[model samples]
Target: MATERPGASDGGATPQEGARTAQQIAGELRSRIDRGVYRVGQLLPTQRELGADFGVSRDSIQRAMRDLQTEGWIESRQGSGSRVIRARRIHTPKARAGQPAPISLGPLISEAFEAEEVSLDACCLTAEALTDHVGVQADRVARGEVNPRSISLRLLLPSTEPKPAFPAAADDPGDTRPYERWAAMVEFHTGRLRDRLLALQRGKFVSDVDVKVRRAPVTPTHKLYLFNGSSALHGLYVVETRAMPLSDGTEVEALDILGLQSTLFHFEKTAFERARLIHNSLVQKVK
Candidate 1:
């Protein structure tokens, strides 16, 4: 697989709207990369093409591309356009039984949504990536591509009131900027996720919808996602000390984790564990 060049970016050509567009386009592209829709070493559509497809300006595309590059997802060149660098990742010690292909969270989530009753439980620091993937499935339900009678979600998040172990000031731990920034992200992404799920119920598409998000007082070192009480995806967070830019145009030394890059381990109730119950919340008992 090809690797992105070190310290390569779009030369900071992001326009005034770059801030908003960075999240908008980068998220969509990120989801695609995660799902393996765009494989490693494959050149993504040119900025002109992506702008037309996504109905955004070329400047916004540039900004989004830069964000992707910074995240180690893609790399861009002067004329060759941007290409995916790290999409699918492999880890050892555990593998899905009888499955030849690598498991993707996208497909598993899609499968759950296809059932008459869909249940999801996730424990994570933020719902940013989950929100992105769920957005795609919601669009499917809206378009009548797949119809499910109900949807249920239980999301466990860290309490916003406490200062987290991550996204903290590296030089001075007392700086509250990181905590404030983390709070804003939790509000924005989780709120959006809740609203999107409820909208399906209001539209009368899904006959029933239950979304319960709880705040856990402690920070979790690993993220866990349970799909329909049958399978679980777990990934451990790796913390790093880096410089984070604040909204006020100043940089701060910070400690953070890149959740997207973490390797996930898949476990099944029947194949992986012998325990009688896989998830206590839903009471998924193994046969």
Candidate 2:
């Protein structure tokens, strides 16, 4: 019988196997962070929890966490668990001439505008992000860079009349000011987005620009963007306990969702059939 080596599964040592496993685990965790399954500034699950979830040994989990930390994706403390420091770049399908890489929302929207006709449907806590990116695209159009003849945008925001949910004061249940602030924010940003899109038509940059806004009764748990029926980008709203300062200098602990910091995951229609169906259904429902 052959004697077993120190790092071997059988007789031969396989140090590379452990390294490869660590790499694979690191990649998966990185993907999750990029896709918002793990969010920035959020503490990651404990090593034991992660080890169980990944069906790996504690050493493997430690190696993967070390890899993430070395790559600047996370930070670990002695007593505290690992926390997400930053998200990795979203890999786009390809690159285009004279256009930047599609790593974030702005570039993705600009890429969408390269089409002859553009359709953007988004449902989120606020239209602030969409509005910001549209502004960037508007500048591109203004420069005669992208000339989409028709642009159709539909926005679905939570109804403010009836307080939906979340953003409530954690300690003081009677205080509803945080909810009110969120509602006002949604309304303001939605209005701004509408005005910006309408301006595109007014400027004669685009022959047809249709902007529609609707109120959803349900509080949004996730933000969804379906781009021209081809691809979908989704991000979950993570409710966190944080303190919010009111206009009158009153600070209260409340449950809140960080919008812009949420990592967005991209999916193509061909790859995720169920996601495609859900996206289509949502579009129709909001229409």
Candidate 3:
């Protein structure tokens, strides 16, 4: 009587069942890899050995190895047997230090503002930067800095308000009143947004803002704003652009800020949640 191999089962199957047998063997091998029974860079058993173990033909074992190779789980060398490859790491986006700060557009809109000759793209991008800035500021606060409060917010429909237009497209055009009104709006919204985000960051309360931009562009632009007490945090904002686009050339711009406001708010409440989680995990490991 011969000794049974590692993958051998009691029942004897026919050659017609070879494909199924090979698949079963492959699955077992994969399971071993997943469970860490077979470590990366470890050579798998020879075809003959695996065939004997699984009570299958050497040809069947070869087929399974080919499958594993095609799937990128293992690589084969002429002199060296098949070796397992470490799995690829997942890709994630994160904030970088010493880079241009994120921008937010939440504060740029006047209650009843207007503009002309401004490219839709410029307006949209600016709005997005504002919201992104808010997120950045919130991150700073989380690190125990003297940063403004910021929150992740979504703008809902009907409550959406359009951005008022600016007089002209001059780069640093010095019209005081429009600029002042614009600055005031930015301050008001930034302060509100920042406070809400800080509350969420400090675990004080869970709050959200819904910003709706109407008549501006087909696509809605989003922004994050920071508030320091009653004042808006200077130069800290973040913006995210929405995917859906309204019909082209629509003249209306609207923004409606909405969401839950309370200490129960968690940082995991926004798009940056996963990145934040990864960053926290890495930091913990370093410590």
Best by lDDT: 2
Candidate 3 or 2, higher TM-score: 2
Which candidate tops TM-score? 1
Full ranking by lDDT: 2, 1, 3
- List, residue by residue over 205-257, the lDDT tens digit for candidate 2: 99999999999688899888888878778877778888888878888899888
Residue 244, model 2: Cα distance from true site in angstroms: 1.5
TM-score of 1: 0.63
TM-score each candidate.
Answer: 0.63, 0.59, 0.28
Superior by TM-score: candidate 1 or candidate 3:
1
lDDT of 1 by residue, 194-251 (tens): 9988999999989999999999778779888899888888888878887877889988
How far does residue 250 in candidate 1 sit from its true spot (Å)? 2.7
Return the clash pairs for model 2, or none: none
Q: On residues 1-287, what C-alpha lDDT tens digit does candidate 3 reach at each position?
A: 22333334745445656666667778888888767787655678888788777766687788788887766566676776777653221111233585433221222221001221111111221232333334433433444533222233332211113333331123334433433334355455545545645465456422332333423322223222322211121221122222222234322222222111101110113447656878999999999
